[model samples]
Target: MNTLLLHCRPGFEGEVCAELSELAANLGVAGYAKGKAGGAHAEFVCSETGGAERLMQGARFNQLIFPRQWARGDYLALPETDRISVLLQALADYPQCGSLWLEVFDTNEGKELSNFCKKFEAPLRKALEKAGRLVEDPSKPRLLLTFKSGREVFLGIAETSNSALWPMGIPRLKFPREAPSRSTLKLEEAWHTFIPREQWDTRLSEDMTGVDLGAAPGGWTYQLVRRGMLVTAIDNGPMAQSLMDTGLVTHLMVDGFTWKPKQPVDWMVCDIVEKPARTAAMVEEWISGGHCREAVVNLKLPMKQRYAEVRKLLQRLDEAFKAERLRVSIACKQLYHDREEVTCHLRRL
Candidate 1:
């Protein structure tokens, strides 16, 4: 493989290219990146043969931000009539894939191919299985076919363990009707992306207490209440009566930035609209001050230099944690529900 296909937010193609170029350089792999504005995807082409494979083997997908999913392969143009046969032949040398995900980009044009992809999947799966190019084993690499057009596709390999669980890394979540606001999906998605399902009950146990900064309308606090946790909702605006009626929350009318709990809580969730630097500083202060054991905060990225800004903000937190001698695990992701902000999860170990 000499090219890496990367998926990112629709307008963040430049960020993906910048991230990949930096990552490839660090891995000592010479590669060039390119993508169109608002394409929702990017590609990295290696200057040397095998460099793509080398970079893929060396880079950790979760560590890199911006790109939700990545695959390694060159594009193929197939005749529309016999595309299945063309695909099977292309996989002659590939290892048996554990699974197959026929995907499209997140753009409008990409969505148009969804129906065709759905129709093509069953026959293709049967054909691959019959040919022994696919198996039920989850330990193997996954076969990824991203269709750009009826006659054009990107046939690639996605490492099962190193890749996102969802196709295109977009987790399909049904917005809860009970949620006070649609913004609640950000926290829900963050948990799904950063924490393991099996550990949810333990980490988010019953009776655990949490605080919601800027919690007006109680959208995020609704999440904590539903989980059987007591919450202190901080905001100047009135909260939803449904959440207040739950009897699991304490609504405090105050500025989230200036408030502090009497004692540390189990968790602190923030969604204040502010500059990325300010948001980062808020999260860092809460973490370093032992205000909460864990936190989920949103950083509204600047219009320019977003990736570079994120790196600096994260580094600031890293340095502060080191100076405080705290063992903290921090992870951040741009959730599908998130607009221009990225969610960050911080847990003290």
Candidate 2:
């Protein structure tokens, strides 16, 4: 197969392509990306056979910023009748699969195919098991049957350990009614995406102290407060009375960009509306100056060439850290709750 299927947000299909193009060049995998602007997925068409698989093996999935999921597969068209026989024939030469995933694009059109995928999954699994193509081994490759339409599908394989944990790489999170704004989900998702669940109790414990910049209305502050951490909410605008009543928050009337904590803080978060590069630079000061040991911030992306812009910004920060001789871990993601911005997490070591 020569195509690597990549799932991304509907409006950001170009980013998926752009990100892979740069990444493939670094891995020495020759490929060009092509896809529709509003489509929920894109493909990196490798120039040679097996090159797609080589790219998959060479690039680390977690390091990828745009693609939610990746699978190397071949496009196939199945007959309306006896689909099972045709599918089985296509996979007859393939190795055993650890698990089967029935996926569709993350668009409205794709949601309409959900019932069909649900109905088709059971019989398909039975056929694979009967043919000895399905197994219980965790180390085996995963079978990805991505349905683009009723009879159109991409038959692909992905390494389970290297792929996203959730189907279609979309995590399901229910918004808490208590949060002051929907933006609260962004910070919550950041913690889950950037920090391992096993480390949550200690890293995000009640004993920690947090500061929320541009914390008007207290959306992000609610998350920190719920963790039982005492938070300093810095904003000139009014904050939510409910959060103020909690008594765990100190509402300071100040500018997030210019304000500095009196002493070092355990966690500092910013959801300020500003240029992406400027927000990143501010976070750098917080980390390098020892104002905060950990931070979660959002970078509002530009209208065009966002992938290229973020890469340059991150490269600039990397150079700065190297010069300062500091150890810090930084992760960024376009979260499900985010629109034109990306959430970032930075931790000092």
Candidate 3:
């Protein structure tokens, strides 16, 4: 029970490990992380007893950049015979869970275990109910059973209110055929990830205005138009004719990095392929200078030290905002639709 399991994007295991290890150290929870390069999961094993519990209590899952989902628990070696009894016995020592989610890594082998997990759920839930270890109380903690294989599993627990609403921190979003490009999904996902659904009407209304930098091909701009927003689409390259036909966009041929909106807009979005630092700085300028009340930007990460760079860039934003006495809320995430990049959202509080 001294291990903290984390799920992340495959191939980013090192970044997740580095970030979690640093975070654990900051919280005075000494631990070492272990994971393969493309394992899609990492484990931080605390040397001190109850260190995992301390880390879980000290850190909020939303503040972590790399890990999609996390839990504190120990491994369960499933026996070939009477596996359900073993699972029941292990869970007997833990508190009752409000919900249960059986999961696996994002790898192919993990996917192969899905059917086994699905089949195991019914009997397991029946046994848990019979044993008084499962309940329907939403306020209680959730039992997360992450299976590496049919024979091995990580039985963990996380508070439902603190963990991601989705199983693996992934939102199920559908791509719209009416959109100009597939890139539209990235912005859509960013909004869902950063903004609360209940606030969508007030924050993203049809009467609002927006500016889209590097709006060529009109992926991100399409999202604004879909919201019935009047958008200034800045780019030198040609845009999608279908989007142009909407008559809600004003195309400006200019550099996204250098161009500034003449009037303060409700929203600003940038998806230009540029240095992460530069993008972060520009986003700060937009919010601090009152160019826009809110912004969503993308940062293209480098091949190495991606997590470190993201941390540095975010820290820079924090310093700048603090110095300028700006009250803003910032959130960033590597969305399901994003690749080698992260989406950032900044809103003035």
The list of candidate 1 runs beyond 4 A from truth reads none
Please provide, for model 1 over 156-224, each residue's C-alpha lDDT reduced to its tens digit, 9 standing for 90 to 100: 897888988699999998888988899888888888888899999988987699999999888788888
lDDT-better candidate, 1 vs 3? 3
| lDDT, each prediction | 0.89, 0.90, 0.90
- Candidate 3 per-residue lDDT, tens place, 1-349, comes to 7899999889889988998889888999987999997899999999999998888888888777778888889999998879999999999888899999998998899889989988999999999989999998999999999999888999999999778768877778888898878999999988887888899998899999999998998999999999999999999999988888988999999988899988899999999999999889899989999999999999999999999999899989988998999898888777767888888889988
Best candidate, TM-score-wise? 1
In terms of lDDT, model 1 sits at 0.89
Question: Is 1 or 3 the stronger prediction by TM-score?
Answer: 1
**Candidate 1: worst-modelled 10 consecutive residues by lDDT:** 332-341
Model 2: per-residue Cα lDDT over 1-349, one tens digit each: 7899999888899998989888889888887998898788999999987899999899778778888888998889988888899999988866789999999999998999989999999999999999999987789999988999989899988999888777888888888998999889889888888888999999999999999999989999999999999999999999999999999999999788989989899999999999998998999999999999999999899999899988888888778887999988877778777888888888889
Please give each candidate's TM-score. Answer: 0.98, 0.96, 0.96
Residue 248 of candidate 1: its Cα lDDT?
90
Instruction: Show model 3 residue runs off by greater than 4 Å.
Output: none
Cα lDDT for residue 317, candidate 1: 91
* Residue 170 displacement (Å), model 1: 1.0
